[model samples]
Target chain A: MAEFFTNPLVQSVLVPVAGGFILTGAIRFANGRAKGPLVAGAAVALGFLVGYVLIVGLPPLPPVSNQQKLAYVVAGGLIIGFLMDFSRRPPFYRELVYIVGAAAALYWMALPKIAGGTAWTYLSLVALWIAAGLIGYRLEKSRANVVNACAPLLVAALGLGLVALFGRTGSYSQLAFSLATAFGGFMLWNWPIARYPFGATLLLGGAGALVTIAYALALYTEASPYALAMLLLCFFAEPVARRIKLPAGKIGEAFRPVAVGAVALIPALAAVAVAYLTAPGQEAGY
Target chain B: MRTRSIIAGAAALMASTALIGTASAADNYKIDATHTNIIFIVDHLGFSNMIGQFQSFEGNFSFDGKSVEGASVKLTIKTASVDTDHEARDKHLSSPDFFNVQEFPEMSFTSTKFEATGDKTAKMTGDLTMLGVTKPVTLDVTFNKADKFPMDPNVFIAGFSAKGTVNRQDFGMKYAAGAIGDNIGLWIEAEGHKQ
Candidate 1:
C-alpha cells in the first residue's frame, strides 16, 4: 500500500488532480459569491503547485538549472493570473499584464543564452517568448468558454505529455500529464453543470503550465518542432466547437464538454502521430 | 693560499648558479585524447552495472614527477558525447534528468591539490562541475610511468589511471534515484605528452 502511494504515477498525476478537485469542490460547496470566484481561481494553481513541489521540489535561492528557473517562472505566472482574477479588469489591462509578465520571465530565463551575443540565439529567444507568450495570453482569454478553456486544453495537455514521453524526456512528460489530470479534476465541476467560475486562475495556470511544458521539451529534448506546431492548432478547438450544432436538452448540456473535447482531440492525436513518426531513431537500452 | 681562496669562492658561485637552474618547475603536458578514455558505471536494477564512456574531451596538466604536490590538472568533457552502446539511453542521459546537455553541454574538472600516498600513487582533489553544479571530488590516481613514447621516441609521455565515485544526486541529477543508482563510478585513463 505504501509502495502504491509512492509510485510515480500516483504521486505525480493522481495527487495533484485530487488536490485540485477537492479544493475547487470545497470552494463551490461552502462559499458565497462575495469573493468565491477569485479564491476559486487558486484551486488549479494549488494543484499544479503540489505536483511541481513533489516532482521538482523547491529550487535553491539562486537557481542554477533550467528546471529550477522553470519553477520560478511558473510561480510568477500563476501569481499574475491570481491578480488578474481579483478584478474584472479591461482586456487591455490583461494584455498588458501578460505582455510584461512574459517579457520579464523570458528576460530572466534567457539572459545567459542571449548574453553570449549570438544574433541567432537572441532571435530564437525572442521567437520562443513570443510563441509561448501568445499561447498563454490567448489561453487565459479563453477562461469563460468550455471549448477553449478546460476541456480542449486538457486534450492539448495530453498530447504534449505524449510528445514529451516519446521524445525521451520523462520529467516534461510527467509535468504535462499532471497538468492534464488537474484539468480533468476541475472539469468535473463544470461538465455536468457550471458550479464554479473558470476565471484567470484556472485558465492561466492551465495555459501557462502547458506552454512552459512544451517550451522546455522543445528546447531541451529531441521532440519535433513540427509536432509541437501541429499541437498549436489546438487554439482552433473552441472555434471549431462553436460551429457544431447541439441538441435541445440536458443531454446536450452534459455532452457539450465531451463534444468539444472530441473536436480538440484531433489536433492532439495528430501531434502525437507526428511526434512518433519523427522521433529520433534509437535502440532502447535495457 | 690567496689563489686557493679565490678559486674556492668562484666554485661556490658556480654551485649556486647550478642550484638555481635545477629548481623544480612544473612540466606542462597536453592530454592525449586519442590515447585517453573517460568511463563511467552505474548499477542497473541491482542485476548489473552498466558502463558508459565519453568520446570527446580536451585537457592538460602540469606535473613535476618528483613533486606530486605541485601537480595540477584541468579537463573538459562534452556531456553530449556520452555513450552506452544504446542510442535511446544516451539521449535519455543527455536530457534534463541526467546531464542536461542542452542546457549544460560540458562537464569540467580542475585539480586543487594532490597528495602522494606512495612512490607511484597519489590522490587528486578537484572540483567537478556537471549539470551546473560543482562538487569536490578526490580520485585515486596512479602514475603508471613516464618515458619517451614507444612509437615516437621524440615525444615524452606520462601515463596515469584514476578512479573515483560520486553521488550524481549531489549534483542535482535526480532521475531514477535508487533504481538507477546514485553512486556513479568514474574511471579515467590518460596519457599526456610533454609540450
Candidate 2:
C-alpha cells in the first residue's frame, strides 16, 4: 500500500480523482439519489480531505500552521455549507453566514500577514474571494444547468493549480489539483444533464477552496499574483458564456457545460501563461 | 584634607577593579557569522548524502569551561537562505514543501537543558521550532576550546561543534518522504567571540 503511493501518478492524479469519485458516488447513493439542493458539496470536501491525508499526509491536529489551518477550514466549511444548503432563511442570514465564514477562514490562513501589519493584503484577498463566492452563489440561485454552474469554478481551480506549479510551489499546486479533480468527480454526475440538485454546498466548497488556496499561494509562496487574479476573474466568464448563442432546448443544454467551461478555460490558460512568464529562475538540470 | 584625598583615591581604584572583574567573568559570547557554518546532510535516493547550508543566521551562547550546566544557546536561521548549490532547488526548498519561507520565514532553537557527558563532551537539549511546530531535540555537543584569539591575544573566543538528527516528517515536511530521506542530519561548526 505504501509502495503504491510512491508512484508519482498515484500520488498526484489517480488517487485524488479516484478517491473523489468513490466518495461522491457513495454520498449520492446514501442520499437516496435525491435532487435536493444537497448534492456534491460534502463529497468533494471530504474527498479532498482524504486525498490530502493520503498524498500529503494529515496536518497537525492543533493546526498551528496555515497548511493545517487550511485542512480545518475545508472541513469546517463542509458543515457550514450543509447548513446553507438546508436553510430557507432570509438572504441576509445566508449572506452573513458566508461572509463570517469567509472572514474566519481568511483570518486563520493569513494570520501571520495580518499580525505583521499587512492588513491591506488580507483585505484585498478577502474582497476578491468574497466576490468569487458571490459569483458562485449567483450561479447556485440561477435556473441554469448544474454543469454550467460548476464548470467555471472547476476550470478556475485547474488554472490556479497550474499557476502554483510553475510559480515554484509544488505542494500548493498539488492541493489545488486535488480540489480540481474532486470537483471533476462531482461534475461527472451532473454532466449532459442535471442528475442532482445544486445549492449552498457547491457554492461554499467550490468558491471556498479557490479563495483559501489563492490566499495561501499569494501570501505563502512566490506564485505570481497576476496569474492568481486573472484566474479569479475567470469565474466572471460565465456572464460572457451566458451571452453566447446556442441551440433552442435540450440540444443546446447538452452543449452548455462545454461552452461555459471552454470560455472560462481561455482566461485560465492565460493565467497559466502569465505564471510561466513570471516564474522565477530557469530549472537547473541535473 | 590629606586623609580625605587618600580615602577618595582608594575608593576610585576599588571601583575600577570591581568593574574589570565583572567584565572578565561574563560568560556570554556572540556567534561570529564569519567563522560559523550551519549545514545539514540528507540522503538523496540512497545514492549519496546531499549537503546544504544556511547562509544567514545569528546566535549567542553562554559557556563557562566544561561545567556544562545551565548554559544556554539560541539561534535563528533564515529559511530563505537555505542553499543546496542549485538556484532552482533552493527556491523550491523555500516553498511549502520544505520551509514554506513565506509563512514561516525563520527556524529557531533555544536550549532548555545541558548535561556533561565527558570532560569535553555534553548533551544539550533544546526546542527546535520549525514550520510553526516545536519539538525537543538533543544534540551531542563538544567543547573544542575556549581561549584568547591567536590573531589578537587580548580578545577572547570560543569554538564548539554540535551534531544531531531530526525527522522532517515530525515537523509536517512530509512531501517526498520515501524518495528524499526523512531523517535530516545536522552539523554545526560554531565559533563565538566574547561580547
Q: Can you list the residue pairs that collide in candidate 1?
A: none
Q: What TM-score against the true chain A does chain A of each candidate get?
A: 0.87, 0.89
Give model 1's DockQ, 2 decimals: 0.48
State the weakest 10-residue window (summed lDDT) of model 2 chain A: A32-41
In CAPRI terms, model 2 is classed as medium
Model 1 TM-score on a 0 to 1 scale: 0.90
Off by over 4 Å in 1: A1-6, A26-33, A87-91, A116-127, A133-141, A146-148, A282-286, B1-23
**For this target, which candidate reaches the highest TM-score against the unseen true structure?**
1
Each prediction's DockQ?
0.48, 0.50
The candidate that achieves the highest DockQ relative to the unseen native structure: 2
Candidate 1 per-residue C-alpha lDDT over B66-148 given as tens digits, one digit per residue, 9 for 90 to 100: 76887999999999999998888888888887898988989999999999999999999999999888999999999988999
